[model samples]
Target chain A: MILIEGKDITLGYEGQGIISGLSFSVEDGDYLCIVGENGSGKSTFVKTVLGLVEPLKGTISYRGGLKKNEIGYLPQQSGIQRDFPSSVLEVVLSGCLNRRKRLFGYTADEKKKALLELERLGMNRERNASFQELSGGQQQRVLLARALMATEKLIFLDEPVTGLDPKTSSELYEIVDELNRGGITIMMVTHDIHPALNDARTILHLSQGRYFFGSKEEYFRSDLGRMFMKEAGHDHH
Target chain B: MIITEILSYPFLVRALLVGILVSVSASLLGVSLVLRRFSMIGDGLSHVGFGALGVAAFLSLPPMAVTVPVVIAAAVVLLHLSSRRKGGGDSAIALISSSALAIGVIAVSAAGVNTDLNAFLFGSILSVSRSDAVVSLLISAVTLFSYSVFYHQIYATTFDPAFATATGIKTERYTALLSLLTALVIVVGMRILGSLLISSLIIFPSAVAMKLGKSYLSVSLIAAAESLIAFVLGFVSSYVFSLPTGASIVLVHLIIFALSVCLRHSIIVFRSHREMI
Candidate 1:
């Protein structure tokens, strides 16, 4: 089953085109990595797919009975946002806000789910700890738990490892790989192409004057892929 | 005896009731405003309220009714302008605030009621009539109701609006409602707390509570309690010592803020000592 299909989507802000005539599709349980240099509209494309930004001129259809909330999202965190005054449980429980109705608190089941997500992420001890006080890897794990509280079918990650050290970054990628293997569809935007491409079945690369979207093997053998690999000194194997 | 005698007066009772209601409403709205970095917008709205009051007074109209809608309108405009243009909020607030202050002063002078205007600018709690109390009661009720209904949404919006939006939450609507409630609270509070000092009721309690508490729910509850306590102390002290009500209330908040800072530091010290032991 095709989970998502973007047909010739054009995205930009305020009448300025960032990426135009772009198309891609994600199959059920597929792992897709979106890679691009600065100002290549990778984040913009993520926003468009998540319904945060409207495509200038195209349609994005979702299959497999997937709703927006059933798709989890972990956006890149700025230092200011990371310092928001909230507890780990509070942040995670907030992911259930959209599911809430009327003036009631989070239901018992919702609380249990949030707690279960925290326990699953190995963050039960930090449930009451301030979010800002946690380490970078711990903070990302907490955010991932929050996203899990939102949905279990699919997750979107934008630069999930931009600031982490080498070890933590690898750990996060491993966790993400595990989730993908567990039948969760993933669409990730990242600059860490080497490891990300290792797990990605599809690679979508947006460049200044061109775009590349195909299977991982095709991306490695394509002229644009070879040029990118040669310029970055990456092992194409 | 003096305390009981003071309590016996219906006017004093009315004043106390209105003070408590205003404090709670202002403090509840304050937490969201302060967290969003829109704290000074309360001060801006209060100045606009003063201007509206001057216009209403000159026209022999009901000040609360006139100021309520006018300040709410300003709140809408400020929120709209701020969201549309980045880095435009502070300047817009400063421009509107100073201009309203100027308009108020001129209107008072032109109306030849300089002495009476002082009561509105600095507050005269003793003069809170029965009708005034009723209006404040209605405002407080609406504020509490709105906050209760939208508590979780407001929490999510305040923490990370981008994530909230990405999750299909209508963040703009909640933010607009918050801004409107803040305007209503400011307008109602200006009648009893005065335009010059009403924002203290909004800022102080929330700031102190944030220092003391770690979670949003706990901080909000503590802030409400602090507002009520400060109002009672300030009101009783002012009545007993013949001091200005607005300044007295603000002074109490200032003291509470200072003490909260000290308490926060002491807790940190104690925790570190415990760790060492």
Candidate 2:
């Protein structure tokens, strides 16, 4: 049932260690939310696990029939995407690329599946619309549909709601909640931990020198949890 | 009449052939380059090509033999630099381009091949040799074939490389492939279209086409068609007016780009008007 296991991973950029000796694992069908401060190596840990960056010192093994390509990934927007001229349909269909074996074009079945994903995400009306012109929440939905095209087994989201109104983010959260309930294992890196507490069963709190990987109940009882929750309270004012 | 004119002049015929091929390939690659905010890469690569031309002239080697490999290496080096900074390459481009230009100016001056130097700077569209045309054709064919075969991979890589890499696409390789082909096109385009006009062929058509088209495919298709038109018109005008070939083509592109700006604005306004109703 273990999907990803990182043992004593030293996470950082270059050779400079930011967060060291961080060991964690995600079970199949578990909602794991990684939360930390801005410089807490949260994104770096996600990158390390995804093999985008190598751990300065540990091995991350993928198990439970979960290949790297099979894990749907929703990365943060790099802003350059705003300049891209892509239709929503085309954007979502690109999710099927990892599943694609041939080099030519998307299959008719793939197109149909992309549409189905759009329909399921309540974005069918915007299929022909320009991706850049879409609202932030709508774009995330389109991106999520693309991610789903990769696999239904597991999904990795890095800072999925960095820039969004609360109501829109919550609506987006509800969709993620639904996916987690449907037995898709979700590993999301988040700055907005308050909303994640709603659905994330396990908390992976990456920090300066250590990381916390435990259930929500245990996290709420910990020192780091209380501090973050207090910080979350201060942000509302 | 234009056909007759083209037939009468061997240079015009050769220019037409090489110009069309280069324009088509340049514009096709330009869509992705512009979208990725790599518009300056063409300019950078062309300068590198110019520098390679100087080195070739200095060594008395066939220009393609030296220029092709050197420019390709520069293209890969540029790719590496750009990817390293992640959305950088503007400064890198400016630095590399200026350095290459200076080196080219010095090397070409030292080589003392005055006539060849002029041809390289302003383009020798009228002087495209048989071998040059053949090389252009082969490079264009390779560029087109790679675009066709790796269409999906290129699309994925351009749109979102992080997602593409996660989905197991070798984004680095494909992007490098794009840059390598672009190097080839720029090198060939430099020889025929002239270094001055080559950047315009890569930048202008795509800018205009992007305004009219909503999807990458539509934009790319529009860019290629628009480039072909610009090259032909520019070619004919250059002949009739006895103006420079590269200058005339660039002017034609400028005119169409201006019209596209106005037309695109009107289309947006008109579409919104219809929506309002």
Candidate 3:
């Protein structure tokens, strides 16, 4: 099923469009990776799709009109955000903030779900630890766990692996892949193209308000793909 | 003992009640401010409240009535202007803070209301009235009730506005509410802690609690406890030593913050040495 569809979307801040005439769609369980250099509107696109920024032109249609609470998002790493005075469990539990019927408290099932999500991420040991004390990779995992506390149907991750060791990045990707296999649609923005190309079924190449979306194999075989690979250095692969 | 003397006085009892009530609200909001890196907003708004006080005195109106609305208005302006610029939070607070202080100083100087400047700049716990104590309790109650009822929404907005918006939480409304609550606390606390020292009461305890790495629930409790302790000690010390009440309270808070820093540093050093060994 098509979960998200953006048709001729124009996105930017305060009506100054950074990226325009963009179109894309994500199916159930599809893993879409967006890759580009800095200021390539990757984050802007994510923000627009997540409804943080209003589209300058087009409409974003969701399948069967899913509630806002159903979409999970993982933003890029912010150093200050890591040091927020919250426990791993508390932070993860906050993902269910929108799901609670009452304005203040959480239900027993919500608490259980939060714990289960932390356990699922193998972060049960650090559940009681302050979020600032976690390693970068661990922080990402905790964020991922928090995202999972909402619906697992559609997940938008912006720059999910910007600052991590190679081993940790690969491990995080493995977890992403596992989630994707479990029927959650994944849209990730990443600078590391090698591992993403291997994992993603679709690639959206954004450059200066233009986007080329298609199969990963087609993107790699294109001239732009060759230039990107050459510029980024093929050695990392 | 000094405790008996303080307990025997009605004004002292009023001061104690006002102190505890305001401490609860200030400490709770302090946690959010510290997290947002705008702890100085309390100081800024308190100065703005001073301007409001000058205006109230010149108009011969109740200071609380005039100050509360003016501070709330300033908070709204602060939040709106800050939201317009990229990374404008800290700069907005700093700008408003300086201008408000300057305006207050000018207003008070021009009006020549024969008011005791020291009483406004430095608090006098002995001046606390039954009516003022009642007002403080009411504002604190409202602040606490609003926060408890809207905690999830506030939590989501503060932690990540984008995610909160995605989840259909109205971020702007909550931000406005936070600012309003902050203004209310500033107005009520201005009398007990003084304009200059109220910000310390709002900030220092939270900073200490954060240093201790306590959970949010525990942080609020500990910050309130710290403030209460500082208030009791400052009140007693001011009486015993004939010192300035507001300055004494602020000094006590500063001492606690300094101690927390030293304790944190020592723990870090101890851990490093243990790891090296």
Residues B185-255 of candidate 1 have per-residue lDDT tens digits of: 88878878789999999999999998988888888999999999999999888888999988999999999
Evaluate every candidate with DockQ and list the scores: 0.65, 0.66, 0.55
List ranges where model 2 is wrong by over 4 Å: A234-237, B8-11, B86-88
lDDT of 2 at B53: 84
Q: Candidate 1 or 3, higher DockQ?
A: 1
Name the best candidate (by TM-score).
Answer: 1
Residue-wise lDDT of candidate 2 within B229-268, one digit each (tens)? Answer: 9999998898888888888899999999999999988988
Across residues A30-76, which tens digit of lDDT does each residue of candidate 1 receive? 89999889898887888888888789988998888887656788888
A40-149 per-residue lDDT for model 2 (tens digits): 89878877777788889988899998886778999997633786888898889889887786778888999999998899889999999989889999999999999999
What TM-scores result for chain A when each predicted structure is judged separately against the true chain A? Answer: 0.94, 0.94, 0.93
Ranking by DockQ: 2, 1, 3
Which has the better TM-score: candidate 1, or candidate 3?
1
Decoy 2 TM-score against native: 0.95
Q: What is the docking quality class of candidate 2?
A: medium
lDDT (CA) for every model shown? 0.86, 0.86, 0.82
Q: What is candidate 3's TM-score against the reference?
A: 0.93
Question: What number of backbone clashes does candidate 2 have, counting pairs of residues 3 or more apart or in separate chains?
Answer: 1
| Number of the candidate with higher DockQ, 2 or 3 | 2
